[model samples]
Target: MTGAPIVHTASGPVRGSWRDAGTPNASAAYLGIPFAAAPVGELRFAAPVPPEPWTEVRDATSYGATALRRDPGGTLIPEPPIPGDAILNVNVFTPAVDDGAKLPVLVWIHGGGYTEGSPASPWYDGSRFNRDSVVTVSLSYRLGFDGFGYIDGAPHNRGVLDWIAGLEWVQRNIAAFGGDPGRVTIGGQSAGGGAVLTLLSMPAAQHLFHGALALSAALADIPADVAKERGERLAGILEIEPTLAGFRSVSESRILKNQPKAVGGRKGLGLLSGLIDDGLPWGPIVDGELVLRPAADALRDGIGADKPLVLGATDDEFTMVADRAPRALRVVPSTALLRGVLRDRGVRRAYLRANRPQRAKGSAAMVGRFVTDHVFRSLVVRVAEARREADAETWVYALTWVSPTKGWACHCLDVPFWFDGLDRERVSDLAGPNPPQSLADDMHGAAVSFVTGGAPGWPAWRTEPGTARVFGGHPQITTTAYDNTLALL
Candidate 1:
């Protein structure tokens, strides 16, 4: 890929380029092309509008702008990779559109706690997948305060709105890239995984994708009352009235800085400063128009009931979250917390009945497991159960493959393996070398199968409750991965 070329977009003609990596006849790859207008300046805090047509051919060869993001060291990915509103962009890697075959489409959403991430992330390289007969598309949506702020006057869930915009772009232009507008599979991990679920619940998103894969998705649906309370608290923190008009005036900096406080219920549980709800005014609203129904509510009534889902979660979920700080373990007195967690996991009697020393080990293990189950594992269960009850076919899996880094099948271990890009980050002293290639090949193959066929290698998850496959050592069937933890909840 040398310079940028203009690609036709629905709104108008936009500029992009064909990337030529040494990967051999690399498909026409376009990166960082905006799908929606940049939400900046006066546009900030508003529902995203499609980007206007460009006058001349703009350079899309170079990665365009990225939303504000704190890199691994908490710097910012957008500082150099491009800049701002360009964040609402999409990257396409296709095997030539005119080839005449309607190919399967896999659109990827990156994960960063809904705070920091971009389409340019290395793990999302679609080269391998594209080479294997699938047209892969990765995109960047708004992130952090820019994407999820709850300003009164501002629309909520800007990130999701951006996602919808990206999907809409895929609908309008993907055919040119050789993708079937009908056979799209939307997928993501962690927060992105949560987004996959959110999309399922969104009425506006129904026609956008045919299948979904949610990997380690931490789906959190805050009640309307709780979310309102959070809006008030965030407003107070910014010294503004909780009202929308008042909060809208607060700087984006204030909103971003205060978001982490909202993550774990700084004000209260349902009050967590997260996804918008009721009428998601900001993103994917359930206003009976855009969303039609809440995602969780939709699953309950079988509203988005038509689409099948493939959902998976790691065994020790929170270990990855905990990995953020090893020293914090000392303060948490994880040992004591472990005992209570085990008791909470329906193993109080069983754990207590064990020898004292054994009880302690059991408690420790259960604590990590409980945290995992609570934050993410439960979501996988709830989504599956809800789908199954609705008579929908959904596949569930529990990944027991432990990483050499001591992080038990923790967060985001799937993407690299799925995209077969592990070697890029393998030498990081912080984590293990790319998961064993066999594991990567197996996972990637499953994803390929799912996109190509309706199966991901393993048997479909049954609605009989608690039936699933554990993709590890022998890929065997298991029931209620954490029955103890479920009873605890």
Candidate 2:
């Protein structure tokens, strides 16, 4: 079991591959193991059903199919394309494939703003975690309209249901992979991070995972009205009713073809084509059914109150947008010019109020800060604050390490460090060569510590120091690093 990478899951036996050829200490990677049935044909837009048990041993040697999604613009991070119908699969990485180990499990939900991304990304390889004695599970769930659309025919939040199904699979079978399901920590970055919070609010998701880590949690919830509008637009584009029957009648190819148009069809927000266009068509919505309330309110009302949690964002989450923005706009924007571009008056006011007399005026940095705080950073703070009020065991952190090459501590910058993926060339491209191994050790260690032991070797937010770990070349614990800006938001 340790050397050959064979383990029996609840469904059947899977043969995985070892990171190193034959080293006993090397991690075993079980790739593309189906946890749920293929959501094709009749199952399209439906809640995931448990995958049928296989009598034969499945080859879990290669990465599985990714969910159907189209990247609107080339992302800074590279994601490889892996094709197939069994997208509702989970990849497992374990140090030992015997029940005697009982290692802690970290189930990762990948982030792509809920529209794109998959567990198949090279950056998501979990062998590094396995090296730390963690049983890491990376899963693929439905994305875009199939995942989050509020259609008339389909139950909302099907993607989330897929996650639940995957977790259930882990609970039933991880023991054979030397994992203790009772010690599972659900974590992800961006949209995946948002899912972590969303699941925390869900009663059905309770007890599925004991602890949570949300990296730069995008806690924004789509209003039911907005979701409905997007759904209607998609339906109209298809020339059919917005119900499940009508949507199911349409081919997945057609759905994927028109998806970008359906998303960009919004009057103002034309999808995430650039840094300026901040809106996305499909995302986690407060459907009043699955998500009864916003995450902060849900936490305030005692949801996930007892769960050990770790949450934080990079210092400059939107700098990528700023850097990529048109030179005329980002290099130096006039106050009036900025206001003219601020389409929504309330946002304009928020930006004006948030910017103080002390800070720099009318520059891309200021604009980036506004977008960063508004979209992600502020929500992390709010959720953390609410969780703190509930007396939940919570530790917060901010990755302030700016890559010497990248210059800005942009969004997704901290991912490779957390995954201990600096060895990967693509990761090194983002993190820069000679990216401090010690820092990767610190951040990766923190995640492993949190997943395994429920505490990341840092003082809780409610403790005397009142600090949040600032991870970098010289990581430190500081109190209220963004308190002043957070107050304005």
Candidate 3:
């Protein structure tokens, strides 16, 4: 209990150090343990393969290399990019080591629009969850073109395969870390949230996890034809054949540099319009194999109907982006801006009528709210509605807490709160000084409750469709949480 704790995993024995040693909240942290081999060389675009076994005790004291080769500057979460090729790893935090405690597990996936994100963020540290008697794990997987891009002769959704490999590792070895693989809950924010929902709807992934939490989920659901087109476009730009051998001929840096160009659309202001119109250019694709259909459609058909789920988005997820062009937006009428995004005249008028409060805030705020509602809030409603007839146990929430620094509820404002990590570094930059610990208690407590039990201290969405736990606001629950978004649908 005092020295570095060692757990004999199925792959090998990993020695982990103690955090807050000699304290009641002390936990064992095993960092950078590989569940799969390095995804370089032959394995780059292939499904994940199991890591080689080791006899020597491997040091699990530091973070491993990230799939993101470089730092993605200006990310809300502090996801520092670590260097090296072995990017398929997991970091586990547990209150007990081989103690037969059988605590519930939370496997978190970081969000970076499916292109960038690191499992090495201090914000994702699992010390808080350990204190609450839940084993926490954050994992790394292939990103960008290497993960999701379609290439001839390559297995589709390699990133998703990596997720399944990681979960399979958990099922095989989590018991050694005092975790119950049977009670595992997978959750994430943004693209990570999308990853959770994608896994939930996947028939291949249903057995790997028992519950799900999706915060501001963004689905790619790229049609097979579209993904193929994008892949061909990328190969054409790189001046290589659109085959596995052609991609392997180019360096990772070359691929990363040119992937954006392949996600072709418009430039400047038209880019925003493109994002709203086209959705994420890269993410899980409906390849008719691994991902049979769009996640919403699958959910509607009763896929993952037996599992409990909690999903929601912040009120103004990306409204802060609008603040950048306040002067120009102020000059243009909100209705004029809506015409560009929502071309249908009747739909535009109905949307404006439903969002009068945002309209009162001026064009910039209105446009920002439109982006948020379009990308995040509407998805929440659609998914909830999809699951209603399926009889899935679902809970919904709205993080209405406005960040004092950002001036809107915004994207990612609820992450640290859900992890109960307000004290983590750089949180003050987003949540500001004097963020309410009481709010963290409420949000994080709900997450813990959901992971430990099936319910999240709120009414299921199916009980009263569209109802949600409204955080950071005066009211506790509301059935009209996504009324404004319903107008757009």
Candidate 4:
């Protein structure tokens, strides 16, 4: 505790520094420890391989390389890309170094639509969780075409394989960091949240963690035929074969440049239509192997029935996008705009009737809410409905706290509250000044309780289907939290 805290991992001894040293909230932070070998050369598109052992104590004071090569400007989360070959790494924070302490663990995955995101973000720091006696970890994996794009000879779902590898490392070495491997909980937001759900449904991944937390999860269960078509189109654009060898011949920059065209990047109205028609283009594909089916289907078939889960999304996940073109959106009637996204007349009428309040907000708000319901909120309901008969409990919640600056309880607004990271940098940009610390205390407390005891301080969805804890101004339980989204199903 005096010098730099050093914990001996299976691979080697790692030296970490302490945060808030000499304070009650102080914790040891082991940063940028590789869980897998550098994915370069022959290993670039293959399954993750264990990292090589080191004799000397590796300095883990700084974050390791991230899969994202360039900065994606204007993101809600500050996912700064760090450049290096060893991108498959993990960052750990612990309250103590004693192996016998046997504290619970929270393994978080950062969200960036599967194309971008870094574990190096300040919002993801685990000091608060560590202070609550939970060992926390953040990890990085290959993104976009390099990780999920289909190639003839390469392994499928390499990003998913990286997740498994990271969890495997935790299982083997977390005890040394004073964490109980059996109490591990996997949590994430956006694409990262989708990853948590995907892992929960995976038969092979059931042993990695005992609980799950999915916030505004966006699943990309692309069909095999669609994946192959996109892969072939990408290869054709680059004038190369769609084989692993041909793709390996091209530079990562070239692939990054041309990958968008393969997925049909539309503009304006076409963009909205394209999104509603086709979900995320790059993510975990159903290969009939590791990921045998769509996550919801697997969950319905009882695939993660034994594990506890907490899932939900904010009230206005992406309505702020509508605020960008208020003038144009104002002129378009809500019904006319809804036609572009929801083709079914009966379903559209039902959805509109269910969400009369959103419809009154104007066409832009109505369309935006529709997109949010279609992509995120509805998934939460679907997953809960899928696990209705399962033995393990499922708790649902909604983040209804509206940001004064953003004007809506938009996406990424709930993350800071969940992590108790309202004080972290850039949070004010989204959360506004003087965000409530009481909300953070309640949300973070529930998360800590769930990670340690396998249940959030709320009634399970199974106990009363459609029941959900609402986190916002005057937090309370609501039975019709996702009533509007139910029309879509």
Candidate 5:
């Protein structure tokens, strides 16, 4: 049980090194293990296929290549970019190796809207989950156009198909790493969380995992025309047709070079501010087969109805937009935008009439609040209610812990606390040098309990006056999640 640990997967044997080598009970890490063949050349836009078998024990100690994407703006947190074709990989962390432990597993999908992000990011280490006797897995799915755009010859939601492929890999190989495939929980934040909800609505992904957690779930979807328009725009930029063959003709670098143009020329907004502004420019689409319908419709229609679920959001999920932008440039919901949103969601005209404002003019904070409630929080609530209506076990939560420096519980502010990653210098920078360890203990403990036992250490969500476990200065269950925001939806 010394040197690097070796275990046999369905494909072949893999060699993994200790993640925190020399540290007490150092976890064994198997990184960059390919779950599918390189999606390149003729295979570029097809569904994932099993990786070519390896006769040799492949090294699984470092991250694999991240999918091709635009570089999000600078950040204290490190998101390393390794480029290559065989990027569909997963990193596994286990408390012990070759011991047949069958520990609970938590498979995490990183968030960067649908356009950018990598599990290779340093903030996604799984050692803490291993410390809690949970086998943690971090995954890298296709992002941006390669992952989600609507092309003529490719299946829509290819990124989600990547997830299904990864889960199928877990079913076949996780046992060798002391994990129980039957006791798996899939979770994510922001766009990743949205993916979780999309998976919940997808029949193809229903049985792959036992439990689910969606943090700051942005339950948003784009119309087919919108997805097609972005794809055509990208093809136009590449001087080709909007098809698989068209994209294949160009280099990934060239495709990325012109991707920003598809979303209004990037405008220097961090991590997907462009997509976020253009209403999720690229993501899950209504392909009529894979997606079937919009996310909300699919969920309310009883997709993944029997599975237990956890839905959560930050108190000010979009409030940081205010802090980042000037008052004049902040996102104040115009009457048209608000009315269109309500109309699209099918909100009752009576409710919209009573709550709709003549015009909103305010500071960045006010604008942020409006966007947070309209875009993120209300959607979280709607999904929770949908799950409840189906008599499913569902739990809701909100992170109200404001950062001392940032002063708002903005998007992605909850990642560190959930993974028990507060000690990482990168996380320390986001949550403050001295963030609350007790909160991390409670939140992470709840996540572990849910993944292992099918309950998130709380009662199921009830109808009317919905409740959510508030995680912040004073953690408690309260019926104040939406605060009558449903009426304004």
Candidate 6:
């Protein structure tokens, strides 16, 4: 089918192919266009430098360069090849914008452990959001070591650089596609959600995005030294030094393939996942230039007081990570690990007194619950409190509708419901036979509302318990669901 008339991007004008699978009835369309300089060869581990503007318009109909591919079996994904180097790119979906007025903008970031996941993943298709009257956009960023990785002498968090660049492209050109530059809302699940949290605290990111929907993440503190060591190891495997000049001499795919092995033993690290947050050669840094401070700490200090925020998590978030974690955390099986973990958080006494697992499953569940609450739930509270610190609008949520098969509501389970796509996965089918159609409808509508005006029919979270807005089964605006879990945690 013929696509929309060619829209002019800042670099040049381009066109898109019309969609055969657009919104249920209407013809929502897609346009994949490049936005930055290619990061091949020498540009490998450097901070994403800007691309030169083009005189000739590039065809934006096809998906631009995706960093690289990944094997979901491992922790990190490999960087993939794009059409050329122009690494900055965005895929957009819009309802026909004939007589234009400003439309809400939604920029989506796909999740894959900061290394995996592509902007073109089918699950992130923007058709539905487009039909709902929001301008939907997805972009390609650096993956694995190409985007993340802590290497000495290398710039930090190139992935974040890529995201900011995409936003810059949107600000300069999305008006052509019928979107408002001032009303952009960035959001995503898992790592993408984590990115949203990071962007929230970034001063460089302040004016670019006005709102964010963090689906199931707030992961932004990278251990610099550890992460840099990881990058050095990745460098060692490729027989290259961990410096920018050394890494630039290697092949993209080879460098990507050697990613998982760079960290050595998974168990030896003590954590199931090992993403370093070291300042330079690793994760997001506290560099005076890039990241200013720990995002959570900044939020709790009220940095992003004006922007609206959405916070939530699935009940079984641990199920996916714990599918194998049960056997893992259960290792130092003497309850020493549990005690140590709590003590580290400075709440061991309170946790032990509140938690008394009486059965094996309860014991396992307790461990899983502790991890979930410590990592995610605490972050959720942290973000909301940060929003509250600034006296900004913050809505708190708990995805209480547990997946039927697994009692723990687990991570990523909320994606189906949030997308109103519960029927798309077998797990969702098991989570709830018919699943509550109202859950998706309400949640999606609430998202649209939140992006537009800072709310979704629930009260803002106060420093209280059981007051979370549940996202299922008539979707109650209540509290006290996981207070006991918090106490035990």
Candidate 6 lDDT over residue span 1-489, tens digit each: 344557767777676756644445353445567677777656666656566666665666667766655435432212234445565678888776642557889898877657667776555667667767788888878877778777667778788888898899889888888888999999888778888888888888888988989887847566565567777778778888788877777777687667767754243223423322111122365555677778877787776767888877765465344445546555544256466555554465456445454124544565565666666776776677667767777787888676665555666667655655555535344455766777778777888787766676787776453468887633476665445455532
TM-score per model over all chains: 0.83, 0.91, 0.98, 0.98, 0.90, 0.86
Query: Model 4, range 1-489, lDDT digits (tens) per residue?
Result: 589999999999999999998889989999999999999998989999999999999999999999999997888889899988999999999995577688999999988889999999999999999989999999998999998999999999999999999999999999999998988999999999999999999999999999999989989898988988999999999999999999999999999988989988664445555668988879998999999999999999899999989999999998887766559666798999888677889998999999999888888788778888988999999999998865657999999899988999998999999999999999999999999999999999999999999999988898888999999844389788988898899
Ranking by lDDT: 3, 4, 2, 5, 6, 1
Considering summed lDDT, which 10 consecutive residues are worst modelled in model 3? 265-274
Model 2 residue runs over 4 Å out of place are 1-3, 21-24, 69-73, 265-279, 331-334, 337-362, 464-466, 473-475
Ranking 1 against 6 by lDDT, winner:
6
Q: Give me candidate 4's TM-score against the actual structure.
A: 0.98
C-alpha lDDT (0 to 100) for residue 164 of candidate 3: 93
Flag the better candidate by TM-score, 2 or 5. Answer: 2
lDDT of each: 0.65, 0.79, 0.91, 0.91, 0.78, 0.68
Cα lDDT, model 6, residue 303: 68
Better of 1 and 6 by TM-score: 6
Every model's Cα RMSD, please?
4.9, 3.1, 1.2, 1.2, 3.6, 4.0
Predicted candidate 4, C-alpha RMSD: 1.2
Worst lDDT run of 10 residues, candidate 1, spans 272-281
Residues 412-474, candidate 1: write the lDDT tens digits: 655667777667644233237545778678778888888877678666667357777676645
Q: Give the true-structure RMSD of model 3.
A: 1.2
**Ten-residue segment with the worst summed lDDT in candidate 5?**
353-362
How close to the true structure is residue 297 of candidate 3, measured as C-alpha lDDT?
Answer: 95
lDDT of 2 by residue, 1-489 (tens): 344577888888999887765565677889999999999888888889988888788899998888844444456556655778888999998885557578999999988878788787778888889888899999989988888888886888888888899999989988898999888999999888988999998877896889999998876477788888878898999999989888888988788788768666432111223323435567778888877887889997889998999998887787555555566765454355456456667766655665653126336566666667667777767777788788888898988888676777878889988998888747766777788888889999999889988899989887842468989734488886556445434
Clash count per candidate = 6, 1, 0, 0, 0, 29
